[model samples]
Target: WHWPTAWCHMFLAPLFAATGLLLRLLLRLLLDLHALFFLPHREAEGFKEQGNAFYIKKDYEEAFNYYTKAIDMCPKNASYYGNRAATLMMLYRYREALEDAQQSVRLDNSFMKGHLREGKCHLSLGNAMAARRCFQKVLELEPDNGQAQQELKNAEAILEYERMAEIGFEKRDFRMVSFPFLRCVMRPLTAASFRQISAPLSGFLLSSPRSDILRMDSTNADALYVRGLCLYYEDCIDKAVQFFVQALRMAPDHDKARLACRNAKALKAKKEEGNKAFKEGSYEAAYELYSEALTIDPNNIKTNAKLYCNRATVGSKLKKLDQAIEDCSKAIKLDETYIKAYLRRAQCYMDTEQYEEAVRDYEKVYQTEKTKEHKHLLKNAQLELKKSKRKDYYKVLGVDKNATEEEIKKAYRKRALLHHPDRHSSATPEVQKEEEKKFKEVGEAFSVLSDPKKKSRYDSGQDLEDDGMNMGDFDANNIFKAFFGGPGGFSFEASGPGNFFFQFG
Candidate 1:
């Protein structure tokens, strides 16, 4: 053991060190764990890279396929799930994306990207409450998450709007409600509420995203006409008119727009005619023209009210007392504070001998009016009320209070002949009825004055109660008997062949 060869052998290294390293390498190859651990992961990363490229290019279909394959290869990978959910969200497949994002979160509870994607999916699906919860959770996990905070604020705003809408609908307070939901869905860029509070916001939504009016192309006329129709429904009458005019300028043969233009033109002409009539003091003509205009445009409030006011004035002037009252009532129904209608109707009632009704209308005008003209009219009405009184029916019949019996008979005969129903065949039914009534009153006056007993009773201011005298009671035979000696004065005899004589002596 103490020899030189033994000392040299003791100082020499092991010959199998290289063999051990080689053996370890062979063992790694046999187990196939190195390729299994790294190569598949590397392939997944390459696929993810390609997917990202395609997604950035907006080739969502290809990106979706590539991401799906990557996710299949790496089933437990949170990043792959997040990418796929994003692509699905872009494709508007929100429900499926929500499931994928939720699975990603389950796989890795600390994944902020997964929470954001899920929240976006919920938002897209109109689940704002759920989206808000998810976004809040993301902010809780990562306090510096600006995107999550912004999204949470948006969700809260949406929730607040929905709550307001619910309260408004419950209380029937539509003016307090905003149409945020419709705006979100339709996404109109330049919207007008169009003075119609209940109108849906989709009415203002343009098919194109741009605000500039489209130029007239070969198809522009058709598009313009369609847009005009939409604008008309949206209550943008001026814009609709412009669109229709443009359409007509481009294609004069467009039947739809031509009809619309013609209707609008006719309506405008009728309105102008009404205004002209009103200015010229032709109230009846103005009412007719306004009514015609309303026939063309039923929703025209100005025309409706103008027609009501003008007709009310016309009815008053024409002495159509009830009609004037109804017209003013309708005018006030259309616009509750129509001072002119109230004033005009008050005057009409005064003319019609309805003092109390006139006073009420005047009071309504006084309550609604702030003008000096109305104040003056109300003062005039009060003065008129003091002077108003019931008219005498006997004076209206144009007969004296103590006319002789022959004079009364002659006057009654003349009046009955003048106002007979047969003389008024072409008159209105109401006029004919009135004439017949006057004729009957004249006959009654003659009958009462002709009878001495009735004349005595009527002269003493006693009410001559009707005893239902028949025509037979006042017949010529009875009058002859009374006038010619009361049942002892008449004789009839056959004097000769075909001849007879009657005598009263």
Candidate 2:
């Protein structure tokens, strides 16, 4: 805050330039010392010194040409081969680097740097076992080498990480974090250069399943702890820590989980406080606390749903139905079977006069649980569904509600010809089923409009004219069976297993 923003940027830029320049100079000086000490074939050594200078100057092509000249003059120098291998690796010519490294080791088996170079080449080629043996051999020669130890550890970790990464890839369709999946190390992460001659593959990666990393059940301490461990193994440390902390806070006596919890930054205190504010009707305060909790562990499905649903409830109280429905939908996506999401969405649908959508929502709830209350609510929904379906008979026939009998008759005949089952003999079974229903609807529309008494009743929403004097002895059940031919003719089981084609309109 003390320094101006413009000044801070200006200050950092030049400092970075100076630091880079200093590094380059230091490297050039070191390479010069190596060339001076290497006294075999003065002309060849001079050429290698030029190569080393060019290498430090970031001109790999020039360095490679000079190194090639040095190798031609003095084919017996292990250091020249090793230096060339290092340059080839920088240029991403890994197989060429491996050949140089092999020559270097062949020239001088005792040369530790030559072996190290070969090990790096093997590692780059994804030859982990070969790389391991090279590192092990270095250890046999020099038992106390720290770089060798760290390199060995990293090679093992690479193997483990790759195995785990593959497992994750198989389980889902996703790339990985860019760091090469940290920033690509000095030694590239991949075993070899990746190439493709086909079309350019390009697309945005979809959002990952964040909910899998989190836990929302405050009472289930053991469950939360177990879930955290699962996430930790999957390399999601940040989310894992959140669950672990919550689990430990709830079950303090759970010694093993508590130990793991100690390793994590906890979210239990804020969440509990948020829950308290919610119950006490301090919604704004609750919102603030939950917001902070979400910042720490946004992926916790249950926790996130609770936050969304709670906010939605407040929005609902304020008559902000649209906002409430949006939040509820978000919660549902996170946890598909979230009962509260279904209930809230159903209420929104009802408020908006989307009776068919409400019926569908209620059907989902009924499938999940069939409590007495749900049964009562479902019956009410069923009634509403029938009324809604039959509410627009005039519209189905493409006639106004106030249209005369002649107009109604003309509209019905037109729609009948367009949607008749025989006209759509080559249509899909589902389409045919819909057409048959529409034909029945059109006939009913004509029946209502033809008679003043029934038309008055239909317009008032006082009747659903399933049966009327349209066609003589027109069996509705026969029409239903013609499409869905089964033992139960037109069985209106809303949630039946064999009800795939049932639109329930």
Against the true structure, whose TM-score is highest?
A: 1
Query: Against the hidden reference, what TM-scores do the models get?
Result: 0.35, 0.31
The C-alpha local distance difference test score for the whole of candidate 2 amounts to 0.66
* lDDT of each candidate versus the true structure: 0.67, 0.66
The 10 consecutive residues of candidate 1 with the worst lDDT sum are: 188-197
Cα shift from native, residue 150, model 1 (Å) = 1.4
TM-score of decoy 1: 0.35
Candidate 1: tens digits of C-alpha lDDT, residues 1-505:
5797786666653546667888999998976976787777888888999999999999998999989889877889998999999998777556679999999999998899999989877766557788898998899899999999988887776666666656655554423333443333232111111112223222323533543235323356755665665565444556778888998888998877887666666766787787798778887787687667766744333335556677777666656778878877766765576677777778888777677788788778777765787677666666556544422224434677676766765665456556555556557999999987665565555666678887676554445554455422343334334543677576545567534455667
User: Where's the lowest-lDDT run of ten residues in candidate 2?
Assistant: 193-202
How do the residues 368-394 of candidate 2 rate in per-residue lDDT, one tens digit apiece? Answer: 998888777666766666667644776
